[model samples]
Target: MFVSELMSTRLITVELDDKLSAVKEIFESVNIHHLLVIESKMVFGVVSDRDLYKALSPNIGTRTETSKDTATLNKRVHQIASRRPIVLPVSATIEEAIYIFNTHNISCIPIVDHEMEPIGIITTRSILKALDEKKITLLATCKTQ
Candidate 1:
């Protein structure tokens, strides 16, 4: 199978200059875990929920919140994003994505075009889900034969 087949095209993006506060709002309001950071309409980096958690103070949004804690929100998306991400082309195979996941510590691989513009994203969960569905389909086909 190709990466494009299993990848998610519903991209949630943030610019390099976007604040962590904005990213926080997006994460809270949306079901997404990763946000693609773009520059000049090209994929620049990736920021995950875990990165935000680690960058921000735990005191944020609490009664004990301090100015120092809230200051973290003022940080830009570029500050915490994983730069120069390992990307894949649409034609890349699922095995290639798996190899990247295994060899790197990244959770998602942005699928880009020839210009390095992101078109989709593939995550470990997506791959596993696709594999499970394929297994079920195969079983069903075998039983019907």
Candidate 2:
């Protein structure tokens, strides 16, 4: 399967000056685990939920919204986001994605166009879901065949 076939087209992105507080809100609103940090129509870094948790003192999800939490969240996303991320083209195969996941300690990868414009994202969950669906389809076909 191709990455484009299963990658999510809906993207959540933040600029350098964007706040972690805003990121927290999006994280809570969506079931996503990663956000692409973009600048000038190009991806600069990636900010995972784990990264956000480590940057916050008490973690934003907790009800303990202390002044420190507010202050820390107000920090620019660029400050807490992991920079210089490796990206994949939408034409890449799913096996390539699995290879990347195995070689790197990353759970999410950003999908971009040839011009480096962000188009979609692929996560471990998406890959698993696709694999399971494909298996089910194949099994059903085998039963009929």
Query: TM-score of the candidate numbered 1?
Result: 0.91
Across residues 72-112, which tens digit of lDDT does each residue of candidate 2 receive? 87877988888878789999987788889989999888999
Candidate 2 backbone overlaps, count: 0
lDDT of model 1 at position 31: 93
Best by TM-score: 1
Q: Give lDDT tens digits, candidate 1, residues 1-145.
A: 6888889999999999999999999999999899999999999999999999999999998999999999999999989999999999999988799889999998999999999999999999898787677732443564699
What's model 1's lDDT at 107?
Answer: 91
Model 2: residues with Cα > 4 Å off, grouped in runs:
59-65, 135-145
- Candidate maximizing lDDT: 1
